[model samples]
Target: MLLAILLPFLSFMIRGKIITGIICLILQFTLIGWLPAAIWAALSLQNARAEKRNEKLIRAIKENSK
Candidate 1:
């Protein structure tokens, strides 16, 4: 139990990226065997969502300006 908890924290302690840490944290709860894979998956999905949201907001602002 402690190691499962510590694995994600260890990744953080090593100064890994924020999204990577977040994914590891999730994997600790969800998929014990695929923590590393989950990290990449989470990061990619989070980034894509953020980018799409940003683009939508930009478009909205541009339309409002006209």
Candidate 2:
């Protein structure tokens, strides 16, 4: 989350979204776009975490059904 706020472009690259990272880098270059880019990065990070949690829950459900 902090990484998303501090370095939004790098955060997207770290998450394997290179194209998005490049676009974010361009947004970061402009003072007006930085806030929106950081918000987008933070939301993306949150979504990734939620997806991971959902996957783990699904796996656990499958194991218990066995």
Candidate 3:
């Protein structure tokens, strides 16, 4: 919940997704586009988290097989 609200700002501050953050920042200024931007940020964050989880799981499986 809180993450969705802060993601756009954090993305820019952390320099993770500069382009997406910039687009969201610009959309935020429009007021109406803010929701879409936030939604986009949230979805992006979710995908990143899932990818990280997958990587960790793969690493664990590889270590156990050895």
Candidate 4:
């Protein structure tokens, strides 16, 4: 819940995606763009998490195979 509120800032600070953050910030200033920006941020975060999980799983699989 709290994360959803600050998604744009978190996207920039934690994920280091300047462009995403900037886009979110710009969208926040507009009437229609706010929701889209938030959705985009959430998706970006989800994708990042999924990528990390996949990387960890691959590493684990390699270790197990060895």
Highest-scoring model, lDDT = 2
Candidate 4: C-alpha RMSD after superposition? 1.9
Q: Between the candidate structures 1 and 3, which one is better when assessed by lDDT?
A: 3
Output the worst ten-in-a-row residue range by lDDT, candidate 2: 28-37
lDDT of 4 by residue, 1-66 (tens): 357455565665566777767767888888687777777777777888799999999999999999
Name the lDDT value of residue 60 in candidate 2.
100
Candidate order by TM-score, highest to lowest? 2, 4, 3, 1
Question: Candidate 3's residue-wise lDDT over 14-37, tens digit each?
Answer: 647667677778888877887787
**Count of backbone clashes for each model?**
0, 0, 0, 0
The C-alpha TM-scores of every prediction are: 0.48, 0.96, 0.77, 0.80
Which 10-residue window of candidate 1 scores lowest in summed lDDT?
Answer: 1-10
The most accurate candidate by TM-score is: 2
Which regions of candidate 3 are displaced past 4 Å? Answer: 1-3
Candidate 2 deviant stretches above 4 angstroms: none
Evaluation by TM-score, superior candidate among 1 and 4: 4
